[model samples]
Target: MQARKDKQVNDMVEKEKIYPLIVDESENIAYISDPETYEVIYLNQAMRETLDLALGEDYKGRYCYDLFQNRKTPCPFCTNDRITKERFYTWKHYNEKLGKYFKLRDKLVEIDGKDYRLEICVDITDSEVHNKDLERQLSAEETVVQCIHALSGNEDMDVAIHSLLEIIGGFYRAEHAFIYECNYSENTVSNTYEWHRKDLMSRKEKLQDIPMEYVAQWKEHFEEEEAVCFPKYCEEGEARLPEILQGLGVRRHMAAPIWEETSEKYGGEKKIAGFIGVDNPTKDIEQVSLLHSVAFFVSNDIYKRRMIYKLKDLSHVDALTGLGNRNSYLEKIEDLKAAHLKSLGVVFVDINGLKYANDHFGHPYGDEMIRSVAQGIRRYFPEYSYRIGGDEFIALYIDGTKEEFEERLDGLRDYAEDECICDFSMGVNFGRGNVNIEEQIGYSDSMMYVEKQVYYGSVLDGRRLQHKALARKLVRDIEAGRFEIYLQPKINLETGAMVGAEALMRREGEDGEILLPDKFISLYETEGVIQYLDCYAFEEVCKLLQEWIKSGGTPVPVSVNFSRLSLMGSRVVNRLAEIRERYEVPPELLVIEVTESVSQMEPRALKGLMEDFEKYKFVVSLDDYGYQYSNLAILINMNFVELKLDKSLVDDLKSNPKARIVVENSIDMCRRLNQVISTAEGIENEDQLNILKEFHCDVGQGYFFSEPLPREVFLEKFGGHHVF
Candidate 1:
C-alpha cells in the first residue's frame, strides 16, 4: 500500500509538469479559474502576454473577469454554467477591451476535487476583417450587375438614366444622384438628370446654366484622378467647396466624368461631355471605381442620343434654304389639326417662271433665285415657313389678326421686289377658328394657280402660251368635228380572231396630219375639256353603231374609253343609255372602259357608278389595270366584265421574271373572279405573245396585230363583224 501511494504521487507530479509545459507552448490563449470564486488559477504564456502580465508574475489572487474584461465582478458572458466535463462549449466573441475578435472553447475542469472553468481562446481578428472585405466586394459586384441590366433593358435615354441613378443612389444609400451636361461652347453646365430619396425636395430646377468656373476644381481633379471625392464639404480652405454645392447643402459627394469622342469638326479629341455624381452617400463613398464604370455607359448613351437628334434635324430641314422640308410640313399639318388657335391664316406662294429660268440659265442660277425667294418669305414669317417644293413655300400664322397677316403679306411682296428676288404668285386665305385646313389650302392653291396663269399670259413664256393656245384650239376642234374615232383590234390569243375593238380618239390637225391622244389628251384634261370630248366620242360611236345595224351586219363589241371626270358627272349613265336607245344599238354590243385612275375616286361613288352602268345593261371593263394605283379592292367591289393589263406590264413580260410572276398571278386572279376576261395590251413581239399565250391570256392587242386605224379603215378591214 505504501509503494502504491508513492507511485500515485509521482504520477500526479509528472502530469502537472507536462500540462504547464504544453499549455505554455500553445499559440492560443488558455486559462483556468475557480468556478465559484472567479479567481484565476492558471494562466498560459499566451494569456499572460495578451494581458500584459509579467512572465513570472503571480496570478493566484487575480480574478478572470478582471484580466479578460477589466471588471471587478464575474463576467455576465462567463460560460461556467454552460460548460461540462464531457463536452466543450464553443463560441465567437469580440472583446471590447482588446478591440479583437476571438473564437473561445470552454470546458469544466477538476483539480483537487473542485470544479473550475478552463477556456482556450483563438484570435480571429484578421479573418473577420478579410470576410468583411469579401462581403463588400460581393455587394459592389451585385450593384454593378444591376446597373448594367438597367442600362441595357431600357431604350429611352431618360428612363434608362433615371433607372441607373435610382440603382446607384440606393446602392450607396445616397440622398441624391444626378447628371450634369457641360457645354464648352457656352462655358456653362446644366443638371440634365436627377434622382432624390423619398421626401427630399428636388434641386434640379434651380441648377440651370451654372458657370463652368463653379466646377473648375472638379474638372482639374477629374483629369488627374479617376473620380473626385469630397468626404466632407468644407469652406475657407484648400478643400473649400464650390458655392453651388454649399448652397445645395451637400455634405459629401463623389463624381466621375463622362467622356465623348468629338467629331472631326471639333478636332476629334476626347472631351468631358458630362459627369455623374452622388451626394451625401451614407456608405462606401470611397468606391470611385463604380462611378467610373457607370460613367462609361452614360457617355455611350449620350453619344447615341446626340447622333439621333442630329440626324432627325437633318431629315426635317431643307439643305438649300434652312427651312422645314416637305416631311416637316406634313407633320405640322397634322399638329395644326389638334392645335387651339383663335385665328388662322395661310399663304401659298409659288415662284413664277421657275421652269423658264431653269431652262434658260444654269440650274445654279435657278437655285439662287429659289433661295432668294425663300429668304424673302422667311423674313416675313420666320417661325412657320416651309419649303414644301423646289419653288413652292407655305406659311401659317396662328392667333393673328387679318390686318396683321395682310401687313406681313405686303411686307413680303415689297421685300421680294426690293431685293430683286424671283417673281412670286401669292395667295392668302384666313379663317376665324377651327377651319378645315385642307379646304383652306385647296382654295389658296386655286388662287395661286389663277395668278400664275395671269402672269404666264402677260409674259411671253413658250410652254405656258402653247398650253393656252392648244386648250383653246382643242375646244374649237371638238366643236368642229376635228376629233375622229380610231380602233385598235383586240384579238383572241389562241385563235387570232378579232373578238373586239377599242375606240380611241384622234385629232385631225389643220394640216391634215393625225395627232395621237398623247399629244393633246393631258392638255384637254387640264382645261376640263376632255369630258366634252368623251361625250362627243360616245355620240359619234352611237351614230356608227346605228349605221352598222342599219346595214344589217353582225357588229362586234366596240369599247369606248371614258375619262374619270366624265363618269363623275350627274346622270352620265342615263345620258349614255339615251344615246344607245337613239341609235337602236344592243346594250351588249357596247363596252364602257374606265381607267385605273378611277380607283382613287371615292369608293362609294365608284361603286355607285358601276351599279349605274349595270342598271343600264352596259358592260364595264377596267382599263389600264396594272398602271398606277392597281388596287385589288376596286376589282372586288366593282362588277367589271374585263380587266385590261397596261402596256408597261406586257412590255416587260419576257425580260423581267418578277413582272412575269405578277402578270401570271394577275391572270390567275382574274380567271377565278367570275371568268373576268384578261386582255394584255402592248404585246409587240412574238416572245411577248408566246408568254401571254403560256399564261392563258384571253385577249391580246398591240402593234404585233396592227396600229390604230381610222373608222373607215377599221370597217373596210374587219367588215363590222367578228373576223377570224
Candidate 2:
C-alpha cells in the first residue's frame, strides 16, 4: 500500500535481494498526496520541519494545500499542472503563503491501485552552489556514496539495489531504470531491479524466461566493455542490430554489462553477471561519464554482496538440505536476546528413525528423507526454519501470536503426516514479549524428545527404539518418493506368453544397490507402517499408468498389494480413487492383491472392504494363499479373480507332500471357481516350472523367466507386450 514511502522504496528489489543495506535518511523533505482528494497520505519529518509543522503527529488525511499554505482553499500555483499519469515534472516554485522558493519534482505513483503524487521538494532556494555541471556530477557521486554506505550494513540486497536504481534513474532523468539479470542455469534473462516514474506500470511480472539468444548483438557490445547505447531505437536498422531492442519500447537506451570478479569453480575464469540499463525519455545524455561511474559502483557492490553471500551460505545454510544451518540458528539466538520480540514462538522438529533408515536402507535413502523434511519446513515456514543438527530442525514464528502459531503448527503437522508421509515429532512454545529464544528452542526440543520416547514405549531397549526409528524414516522415504517401482513380468504358464506384471517397491542403496522389499517389509508390517507403504506403491503405479498413457501405450493390469491396515477404513478407497480418477485409469486395469493376513482380519470388515473394491470394478486376488491362517470364507464372499499359492508351498513341492497337497487343492479349488492360480518363487529350475504347468497354473513370477526390472528396462523389454 502506498503511504509516505521513502524515495528508494521498490517491491522488486527488496523482497528477493537477500542481502540488504542500510542508508541514512535523505535531508530533502518528501510526501505523497492522493491526487483525487489533494489529501496527504504521508509527510516525512524533513518536510514537517521545513514547513514549520509539528512532527510525530497524525497529519495523514490532512489537505496538502491547506496544511502547507494555511489556505482556505486550493493553491493557485500547483506543479501538478505540468505532470500527468505518464509524465514527470521538475522545476523551481515560490509558495504564495510561505513566501519561499523551492526546487521541486513531482511524479504520479500508484500504490495499492490508487493514484498519488510523490512530491520531492528540496529547499535549494538558500543554496550558494550554482554550477550546473558541478552540481550534477556531485549529486550523482553523493547518491553513489550513500548507496555504498548502505552496502556496508548486513541488510537486504533489495534495499541496496533500490538505492542504486533511484540514483541511476535521477542521474539519467529516465522514465524507467532497471537491472536485467541472467540466470546462467536456465540460460535466460529477467528484469529484477526496476524503478518506474510515478504512476508507471512495472514490467517485471510480465518479463520471464527471456532467451539470451534473442539479444546476442546487445551482449556482444557489452563484451567489448562498452555501455551500449542506441538513442534512436526506431531508426536503428535490423541488419546490424538486435531486433529485440526494438521489440521493447526503448527509445534512448544505454546499458553497461555487470561483471563479477569470481568464478563458479574456484581459481577459474571470472564471468559476466548481468547488465544495468536506463531509458532516457528526456534524452539527457550529457552525464554519460557520470552514468558509467555509477554503473561501475553498482557492479562492484553487487560482486561484493555476492561474495559475502557465498561466505555466509557456507556457515548459515545446511550443506545437505539447504535450510538455515546451526550457525544461523546461533546468530538468531543473539538477535533474539538483543530485541524485545513480542509473541515469539519456536517449533522443534525431530526426524524419527533416521539412524534406522541409514542403517537399513543406506545413507542415501536417509539423506533423501532428511531433504524431504527440510523441504516441508521450508514450505510451511520459509525464512524461519533451521537445520540445527542431523535430523533436527527448528522454526521461529514471529509474525503471529502464540495461539495462532500453535494452530498453524498443528495444521502443518497433520499435512506433513497425512499427505507428505513425513513422520515427525514437533514440540512448540510461544507467547508474549522479551522471551529467551535459546531457552525456548531447548524447551521445545525437550518436549519433542519426550514425545519420541513415549512413542518408543519409554523403554531403554536399543533394538526396539531402533526399529521404531526406522518406521519413522520409512515414512519420510515414502513421502519423498525414494522408492523405485520395479515390475516383475507374470507369464502365462500354458500359453508361454507374457501377461501382466506385479509392481514391486525397492529402495536405492549405497553405490546404486537395489534394496529389496523383503529386506524391511516384515519390520514395517509388524509396526503397522505397511499401510502407508502400500498407499505409496498404489500412487506410484497410478502415476506410471498415466505416464504410459501419455506416451501412447495401452497398459496391462498392474497388481498392487494391499495391507490389512488399509482395509479397516475408507482412507485407502478415497486415496486410490483420487489417483485413479486423476490418471483416468479404468478400475479393471488395476488388480488389487490382498495378503493372507487381510483374509484373517475382522471378517465382516474385510468382506465389506473387498466389496467396496468390487463395486469399483477392480479384479481382486488373494496373495500368498497358504502362508497364514487360510479362511476359505473370504474366497467365496470376495469373488476373487485369481489366487497366488504361497512361496513356501511352491518351494517344497518336490519333497513336502503336505505342500503339494495344499497347492493341488488350491489349484483345483481355483479351477472350480473359474479363477486363475499363480505360483510364485522357487521357479529357478525347469522341474519346478513343469510341476506348476502340470497343476494348470495360469501365471508365474520369479527368477525362472526374469527378475524385477526398472521402468526403463521393463518398457524396453516387455512394456510393448500388452496383455489387453
Per-residue lDDT tens digits for candidate 1, residues 593-687, read: 99878877788888888889888999999999887768888888888899999999998988899999999999998899999999999878999
Q: Model 2 misses residue 111 by how many Å?
A: 76
Tell me which residue pairs clash in candidate 1: none
Tens digits of per-residue lDDT, candidate 2, 1-724, equal 3543542453333343211211132566777777778888766667777777754576767898888878877777776656766766888776766666678878886665656777777766455234555787787677667656756553788887876676678767787888888888789888888988786777777667789897676577777645767553445553243556555666577777776665555566656677787875464465555555666777887777778888978888898888889999888888878887777888898877777767765777678678877887787778688999998999888857666776778777766665443356788888676677777778898999888887667544445544444566677666655788898888888876777888888986545577898876776777566777887888888888888888898777889887777666565676687888988988877888887677666767776787677667778778888786687877767778888877777888888887777787788888888655554554666777888878777788788888889978988888788441
> Which whole-number lDDT from 0 to 100 does residue 481 have in model 1?
75
Q: Looking at model 2, report the run of 10 residues with the lowest lDDT sum.
A: 16-25
- Model 1 poorest 10 in a row by lDDT: 464-473
RMSD of 1: 26.2
User: What overall lDDT goes with each candidate model?
Assistant: 0.83, 0.73
